[model samples]
Target chain A: MIVKDAVCPFCGCLCDDIEVEVEEGRVVAVTNACELGTTKFMGEKRMKNPILRVGDEWKDITYDEAVKYAADMLLAAERPLLYGWSGTHGEAQCVGVHMAELIHGVIDNTSSVCHGPSILAIQEVGHPGCTLGVVKNRADLVIYWGSNPIDAHPRHLSRYTRYAEGFFLENAFRDRKVIVVDVRKTESANIADEFIKIRPGGDYAVLSALRAIVQGKADTIPRTVAGVTREQLVRVANLCKSAKFGAVYFGLGLTMTQGKYKNIRNAIELVSELSRHTKFTISAMRGHYNVYGSNEVNTWMTGYPFGIDFSRGIAFYNPGETTAVDILARKECDAALIVGSDPAAHFPRKCLEHLAEIPVVQLDPYPNATTAFCNVQIPVAVTGIDAEGTAYRMDGVPIRTRRVLSSDYLSDEEVLARMYALMQEARER
Target chain B: MKVTLAMKPAAKWFIPIEAESIVPKNFLSGTDLRVWRGNRELRLDEVFSVSVEGDADRAEDVEVVLSGDTFRLKRVGEYLDAGKITVLGGIGMHCGNFMSGGTIEIHGNADGWLGREMAGGTIVCRGDAADYCASGYRGGRKGMKGGTVEVFGRAGDFLAESLAGGTVIVHGDAGDMTGAEMRGGTLVVHGDCSRPAANMKDGSCYVYGTARGMIPTFKKIGTVQHDGRTLIRFSGDLANRGKGNLFVKGYEYLD
Candidate 1:
């Protein structure tokens, strides 16, 4: 049977037009989704039961025992870390926050590594952004700065910016312009009308020069700014000004560069400057499907987007200090609960060293890199496949992911609810 | 009163202690106070061997001296409106956060966010200072609104980021994005710095040494004499308001 309108729980695009053919409780084929989303829909080798590490090997454990053990460990810990909610649904993320507040611990998400810098920049200069639908409808000029959507978010162009049918344009594909800015020529750059290659860590300098050019200070700018000629800068500035509506989408390449958040701030300020002449907007090309949801929930519930510390019984936020990477690397957390995302695959070696020392509990479907560090690993249903919940898109649009198949395994929300229930029980005592 | 806190050895050296209440005014109330190790709150005496040298009537008369592995202690003088704090060795992150008045002296190296958001008083770091020194909190519009921060040694990245109103002086080479987004302030770097006074609207940044990767927008406005040295003055970052002044003895661009 084909399940229609299932959200692909992969990239931040959160494509909801997926058609999944499931037979005998497993996904056999998928359509209307990218290669990355198709792979997640047809995932394999899911653990049947929860396992605990005894000495050097694994020991099968009941769900009740696992939940109780996780609760007891968190209750006893002085500084616990609840991390990795980006891969899960919003319901599970809600429970995670309450647990952190109750346990007096730190709660952070995958954004700390990806678009956290973008948020920092937005806080400083304020974001001037619009939804993906708005960009597809009205934007005549689309700039993919420091991002290669062709390789990462494969359907981004076909769905929204470059190839998507525009509502206002006479000829959507013919009239819309595409520009790719990066340190190197990427696959996405191949299709762009303009591909401006830059020097490594030169994004900040380049951005500053463009801002000056936009402000009519072109004469003050040097002949070349960060490998881009003054002529090219002026041309780009003119293109932005001439366009009726422009949209900019940036990725990790800009945020993780030398200046980090300052680069995004400059970009936003540039957009603000260009807005005086034409309509413009800027948005982050978020990585995970639900990472934006994590930020949304955390912000509304705790006032901060991520890297929140409840150690003082009130939510105290400081990103660099309370973030997961800094917490693990500094050996601040004695116990850790990892839900949905893998830290061992991404975290630095220093953080892995502390992960090895701490007692860790993880809730995931497959045995990923983080499984190696977990003393207790519990299997759960994957969102949009056997489980369904709300997920926020890259542009902050909420879509309720539809379930495609039946599964014996519990969902992330069910598993976390069990843990939170036990925690509440222990707290009342 | 002179309060002395000598840190005691801990089983876990990695877990830091937060003693934001260690300021002189808090001590004027009584010897009783609280500090945090992770989520666990402990008596001030639990982490340190506390002693009172004398009695005082006002906050200005009280001074706090910290010794022994104080590098792991954080927020030593937060919200310090007055008084003085002296760290014998290296100090930790947020040594004097949001301090409106008083003085903090660190003999050894200081960590990130040293003297952060200090509205008044002075902080003298005899050793090298880490990132975000004399800067604002994350997402705060203004930093170091009014105060003085002097680092006798080298400093790290984003030094005095978003500096609004204050004076910061560094004797050795400073790091990237110095005086970034500074709207009102005076910054002096005795040695070289990268991308000094970036995106600043209104302020004065002086680099006695070479300025590397000079932003392209700042317009050259001839030369001027500053403190017996003939420096090149530029009116920028023209990218923004183009009102800020940048003075550099020498400069280089990535061009």
Candidate 2:
């Protein structure tokens, strides 16, 4: 036995066409999964080992005891925040939102730091976007900006951009003019026919100059401008303008830099301007598979995309006001329930400073940086591995996450339901 | 009419909504417009008619406060000739982009890409700015044309690239490769810089920092400078024949 349709929730790709063979309630073999996915499938699954912090050290406790303590801490807190949900199921995400509402706490996703800029750009100017399938099949000009997919998304080029054969684009890399723009030279850049190195934070500036030349503007300087000259600028612009179909892909290099949000804003605006010439679009290289799904669901339900705050009982949004980073850094929150993300490793130095001060609860499969600092740690089954759910790919395509292995641990949804029940019980008491 | 954009905090996300434009009665003591969503989208000619007018006392109390919580607007077009919009606190990404007319100024540090794919506009930053201040996006090529960005503080990487037109001036140190694959544009860096400087076949960069190892692909050319500072130039990114030139001077970094 195996599931014909399985999904891999290892990264933002959320590849849904996975086949698995299970034996003895465990996955024996998996097909169409990336390296990270394979590691996830064969990894160790521990027991209910919920740990509690007494004063300094941690002690393993029963699930019931841990759950009870978690409930108590949450109930006692004045402003409790629930963050993260990328690796969890949609059902669990719904439960987490409800919990935040009942507690009048702030609820934020991983977007507070990582791809928050991309989300903001989308809200400003709607995205002219398509799925990966569209890129493989139709895109003739592929441009990677501030990202090295070879390291991050290993199979991106082989499966879609450079290797795979689509209906329309039979010749993959040969037909496509690969261009890599980044701060440092990367492996992906090595393969690109044209590797244009822009100064860090200079992407916005460089793009402006190129657009100026494309529109037929003349400017002369005795020396080079940021290492580039006038003739090459015109040629690159010509390549973009002549392409039948083009795609601009970028990653954290843009968002993580000093110009985090501005990077994505310019990227989107660039794609928008490219569309004026021919057919051009762009996609953010999202890290978590279900992040796009969460954004989609949250957007449809609420007018705002992410970093939501429910302090007034009803939904009121001010991204700067509701952003998790600001709330945590300012020490406005007292307690927190973190889901799938590992903020200890990813968040800035200032953000982690405040997170350490709160009474934190973590729901994760493994012991990550955030879990190590939490007061209560509850283990949960990894979505698409031990639990099945629906998630969205980086391109905003929803796919069914399949369950191949069985687990004794609680699902994220189950844990959330239990917490909600405990909260309701306390209110009635 | 003054347009007020505001966002409210919900449990999971922030809700952003643009308010209907309203005409203000006062031409002085500029009206305050708040953005609930970190990003506020204003159509061309929407806020060009309004101005911040006669509020010496009010200006002292709150120097153009645009709070994220309250959705308010200040109109002073009746008393002033030009409209001035000054953001008091930190703003979301693309704070000022694609403005054909009028001036939009940010007082605090702004997120990435200052004047994104700008056609016409004047944007000035009082604080540091993030990457891609006035560059083109990935893939389609063609960047800023007919606009200007002046960063008074330090700037993040990729100051400008894939540029077709525009002038960018950084008063402080800039991140790696001031301009990479730029086609056309003028960039002036008044501080230190990092590597792989520029890969463009076109455009001009004036750096005051030490020039590092030039890509084996780029050919050594000449040198030039403004205000008495010397700068070395090289034509490079032979990967594209780019005829693009890179200028660096002072600490001798040519590799």
Best by TM-score: 1
Worst 10 residues of 2 chain A by lDDT: A217-226
Error of 2 at A15 (Å): 1.5
| Span of 10 residues, lowest total lDDT, candidate 1 chain A | A163-172
- By how many angstroms RMSD does model 1 differ from the true structure? 1.1
Q: List clashing residue pairs in candidate 1.
A: B119-B146, B145-B165
DockQ of each: 0.77, 0.04
Docking class of 2: incorrect
> Candidate 1, residue B210: CA error in Å?
2.0
Candidate 1 segments whose C-alpha is farther than 4 A from its true place: none
- What TM-score goes with each of the models? 0.99, 0.65
What tens digits encode model 1's per-residue C-alpha lDDT throughout B90-155? 998999999999999999999889988889989999999999999998888999899999999999
lDDT of 1 by residue, A167-268 (tens): 897777999999999999999999999989888888888999998888787988889888999999999999999999999999999998988999999999
Total clashing residue pairs per candidate? 2, 97
